[model samples]
Target: MIDTVALPRPYQNYVYAYPHKTAYRPLTPRPAIADLWSGESTSTLSLYLHIPFCEVRCGFCNLFTRVGAPDGLTGRYLDALTRQAEAVRAALGDTEPVRFANAAFGGGTPTFLEAGELTRLCDIAEHVMGADLRAVPLSVEASPSTATADRLGVLAERGTTRLSLGVQSFIDEEARAAVRPQRRADVEAALGRIRDTDIPVLNIDLIYGIDGQTAASWRLSLDAALAWRPEEIYLYPLYVRPLTGLGRNVDPVAAEHDWDEQRLRRYEEGRDHLLAEGYTQVSMRMFRRLDAPPQGPDDYACQTDGMIGLGCGARSYTSGVHYSFDYAVAPREVRAIIDTYTATTDFTRAAYGRVIDGDEAERRYLLQSLLQADGFSVAEYRGLFGRDPRDGFSTELGSLAERGWLDDAGSDRLRLSPRGLAYSDAMGPEFFSPAVRAAMAAYEHR
Candidate 1:
């Protein structure tokens, strides 16, 4: 049996995207975006437009977004987005039909822009990029404070199927502790506004591991969210990192064991509660109501399809390359990057990113699939690479199996045991390539 004692903390890292942007560096003699997409299948691409403006920066946020925009900054940013979209659309070429399978507007807070600006943003996706917003499943992220009637109306009119609201805590005191300025009354009103619109799926984002958050208090937030009957609920474990508001005073190393234990307990409790309430677990952080109408096409797989990300804060992915502009967390640096992006007239080439080799591709496929609650098909892996995961990942699979993390039911598929799902954070990092790990490590977090 594998000895669990020597393993690191369970919440080591959250692997939302493989070979994270930190591993990306400047690509010398930058490759033209056209050349990168040339010969690649353009059908069923996912589109993402990023809005980097937020009303308030959450204490725990490390996202690449500025707190507020200057008078004309939002306009200038939109102009830049329009120019970039034109360049990308042209690059996609005319030989084959380019179609979007799914679309999303994310940020800091996408709804941070005014109503008319939101309309323009959607126009860029539809008019410039050729995505049929009305046909595809469109998801947008917003904060309770910014989920206004005007913004919700624009999103609904644009065929936004999902609206993800960031409500860290519904309790007034907890919200204050998390440095997210809002009241339960205001959040409820915002939820009401969202429901008044035609947007079908409402996702409430809640966080655990806040100071003074107990099982009872956590239930308060959960019950409040459930009362709204949101289609989706995302429970995120609070992570304090450098340059964030909460990181300023708290020592990340302090109370290590106790904090991990508390977070794990909360996670398990939340998971069980949601499961009992008929919410299906999509991932460690995501739970979807069983009756919630499904959005997006079943055939659009994130692992294989190309993703076109518009804006300074977003990243574009092709088969071989994942590229984006400079990334930063500090407000000043973020502003500088955004300014630089808006100033540039040339949006033709990839300025910075990392190349995905054959080995890294396999790792990405396995890691992204295995971390999900549904697990992955070994047959699919064999079909893709001509070899099964058991051959490529013998050591890692052995360790997980011995530790009782792997559910070795049948050879047709590979799945995580209940205990394995709980340790997804640790398991994900275990699959990172040494080169990618070194690149991420050497990246100086600003």
Candidate 2:
């Protein structure tokens, strides 16, 4: 068993405000003009289809989803999704060629669908996307139990290069205790089956900070995870949210370790250990193959530019604006997610997709680069912003550099120091728009 680290409540940076929060932004500029725009038109795009059914809901999970969602209606959902894709293509008109540069299938568990239904979903998407999906990174999320040789074979055949298996924990005892059904052996077998196919990347999702979790136990699990040598590892600390089993399990007073800082420390320790083993930390909580060169502004730019989304609770972006209407369409909750995604996009005709104005663009540009890896390429920033970022964010950049959080190679690139990585996410957004900052600040208060 792992030893649990207990902390006093006061040490938790119980700040009245955490002071770091920002929205997603694409790194590259989109060629969108309001004048001649008639329909969706973008060359580089990503695809994300949601599978809303799950065998059972995990204790600490919060994504737009449903459990025991009707699987019989999957065919209809596929039809609606294809219509949505076609609508996207038609909106862009017949002149522009729509291309899918990247694609991902998320879910309750994408494998929740039967084999044939899954294949049809991908087939229609490929037809509407108008391009070979193999040319780009493709991913699908699956739980341990639902994965089988047949299902994995289908996924691999359909261009899924990455598999993010939901292996929240390897401790079968605790796993069963959490009301989440998982078998240690099953997770291993799923990985084996997927590996036998063409999927190159196997990402395991590890959840820490469960009610009865300890560092030793978590580390032991990490050792077990590392033994599998997955191409990527995503570590998510357990969090309690409304409507989740964790919410019911959470007892502030009764819980032994609940301080935010302590939770964060545990994460940092895991991160450092993983890095020691030659895994490169990519996105937040995501460590990937050491050989996978860091994704630069270019990758983030393409993803943020324009993409189509489908299934219940998915979001799509067009020309820097976001619209999310993918709801399960349950006769009762149909209006819930629909009203939010459709009505909001229609009314606002806007979103914080990118920093549009030159000045705001510069601020966010620095913020994003730093937030990603506590590093920003000075040259790239100059090329995009049309001005030196050091000059653009002269004061903040200089202050951070002076504080040792920022590093520069005489203007080629900038990266955060080891200490800087600790506060990069929260600190980057302090300079963001007040509204955005305030909204994120509210999270800490909660």
Candidate 3:
């Protein structure tokens, strides 16, 4: 058996905050509709709608979505989404109406659909899901090729507060190295169109650690992204996972030490550059402009509140359960799942997921907040669990403290020092429950 304890630097075991979908198993004789949502608060919730169709697949992407659907498939998928939304809203019941405080549209790419289909997508969120898109902060993900004038116009009219464009790299050669087929000229044009729509906030996503990428190329991409004065930016490290385009060509273990050093240096370079440009680091991956208006609901906390997700790839969260439809990484397997989803009529019960016990919930609460720059609050954790985190996670906390990864200045909170933040990928999984780790190891991913 492989020793997970000694995994190399930049240990990308799991993203943390929640167990990966791979660990989820089929819920045989699925939980009852009422029981699945029992005791779930309706005061405030987040709505996530998935559009699992993209124009093209990126090399490093392992999200539970498929590339461009065939002709008419998009329409059928939207129809299925509408059916799912109706069923879900009904499941929430009339006794206590759930109010959505924030909404997001993610997928392979939500903008891959035609302009008219995009309108229908918004309708499903508003009319079917009862989430007033205009009232809630709505975020939509787009790509250079698909952020057309027509689509941007529709999104703006439908109250999309934020537009997140995936510009992996502004350098043409670097883009090619990442196996993302797009020209710098096209990316600039897409940015221009997005600006024309006057979306309240713009977010640009960039990746580092691609083959042939250097500090100079990284700076070029950062400079180009900064030119837009985006409200938020996400810098992601390239992780070539199994079955991905890049994974097939690269050996993850080969030169692991060298790759880790390169990624760390580039990450620091990007972070420092953004900070100098007047952006505040929210976490290791996210940076936001200090002067920009708030984009999300201030009251919604991922750990405590519930989330309603629609469509095949979206995951829903209640107090005790985190569930979604079947997940896959292989292209053929993904296509089959999407096909099955489009034909489904029953959306009341979860198909696959793990039940979050009290211990798992505490772990999630700590991981999610401690990873943030603001850190986790001892007072709040006490209020929720009636005990100190150090009592339950004493060994883990003590280890992190001994390694100087934790901030020792504050007694009321636990925050990561700069070094801890740099090794976040490793620090996150260290807190996972043993049961979760075993379950994830047994999962068979395609």
Candidate 4:
């Protein structure tokens, strides 16, 4: 019941010609076992359930989804999510009774579900995945106007603890022009209601540089957002992507409007404002409570080892391979994921593509593992892969130490220094493939 097909050598050669390494990811020399899911289970696991339905699709949004006309709606889809969880369970072998807290319902808008459907999906996640998701953090995305008291209650009762509300901008005009729905009063009430339930954290997402926004107005929204005192705040700058309405309106100089000094100034001023508010920098775009660890990639990677992404336009990362599928997928890529993971249940690194020689594997392990704030741990690395990262990566760390990008405090811990944190976004992709490394490095040099 599995497709054992493989890409011909010619296609693999064609793929390698371009710099899209992920395209040819399952290359030989990855892991040696048939099961890429081998080794000790990680401390956490995350599931990104994409709900591709939205009441209104904003002009700037590029996520895979449909709006309003609601033709393909059904409860069967929710059932499918649970079923996929089972298929994953079967594939993962003895899933090490892992303790997982984080599962995010993301999308064009996850709150697109009507009350009954929303609660049902939560129930499905609990029934299938919660068998192992004991005493852990569980969260979901909320749209201000749609997430009413009743809806919040259902999510809270059904194990949803954290709520990341899409409060893009507080200005009514900008909110309307961006086609995002928000009401200062409504959002305040909703936050108050959700807080009453005593959920551990509330993350408010803020965006800047919409078509109608000026630097002053953007600053106003930032200050208004800070008034709520959220446990977390995420700032997203508007970027023009291919094929969207905003993309169509791109200015050669400014991807959004004019891409001028004003836009860059807004980013710099906003960055300064957040730091002044006592928000320690995490990733380039995220800031969080000083007491809480910076979130995103670092906190994220710790919990996410092998993700099982379901629904449209989701990406899954495992030991040596990253599998992605949309509502539609490139035929070759889909076939490869199915064939590589399903066919070779006990499959190892070689089947993935390149042979992950010990040195290469150690190098990669360090890059992927050290991506977050907690940094790389020598003991955990040895426990999982049977060797120390110190043995393979100390040379690179020692060299990087002089640049003030890394620190090995008392715990044999490695972390990005303050200066290193500032340029991390620019520095991150260098750890990937050769072409990406060149591109990122060139970006920095420019």
In order, candidate lDDTs are 0.91, 0.62, 0.87, 0.57
Angstrom error of the Cα, residue 67, model 3: value is 1.8
Q: Pick the candidate with the highest lDDT.
A: 1
* TM-score, one value per model: 0.98, 0.77, 0.96, 0.69
Task: Put the candidates in lDDT order, highest first.
Answer: 1, 3, 2, 4
Root-mean-square deviation of Cα positions for candidate 3 versus the true structure, in angstroms: 2.9
Candidate rank order under TM-score: 1, 3, 2, 4
Task: Look at candidate 1 and tell me the lDDT of residue 37.
Answer: 97
Q: Please give the distance, in angstroms, between residue 395's alpha carbon in candidate 2 and its true position after superposition.
A: 6.7
Instruction: Give me the displacement of residue 248 in model 2, in angstroms.
Output: 4.3
lDDT, residue 344, model 2: 34
Top candidate when judged by TM-score against the true structure? 1
Question: Which runs in model 4 stand beyond 4 Å of their true positions?
Answer: 1-44, 69-72, 93-101, 131-134, 177-185, 252-264, 291-304, 327-420, 435-446
lDDT (10s digit) by residue, model 1, range 358-443: 99889999998998888888888899989988889888887788778887845688988878888898899999999999999999
Q: On a 0 to 1 TM-score scale, where does candidate 2 land against the true structure?
A: 0.77
Clashing pairs in 2: 2-216, 2-217, 27-301, 39-91, 40-92, 313-326, 374-416, 375-415
lDDT of 1 at 347: 97
Runs of candidate 1 with Cα error greater than 4 angstroms are 1-6, 296-298
lDDT of 3 by residue, 295-315 (tens): 655478887899988889988
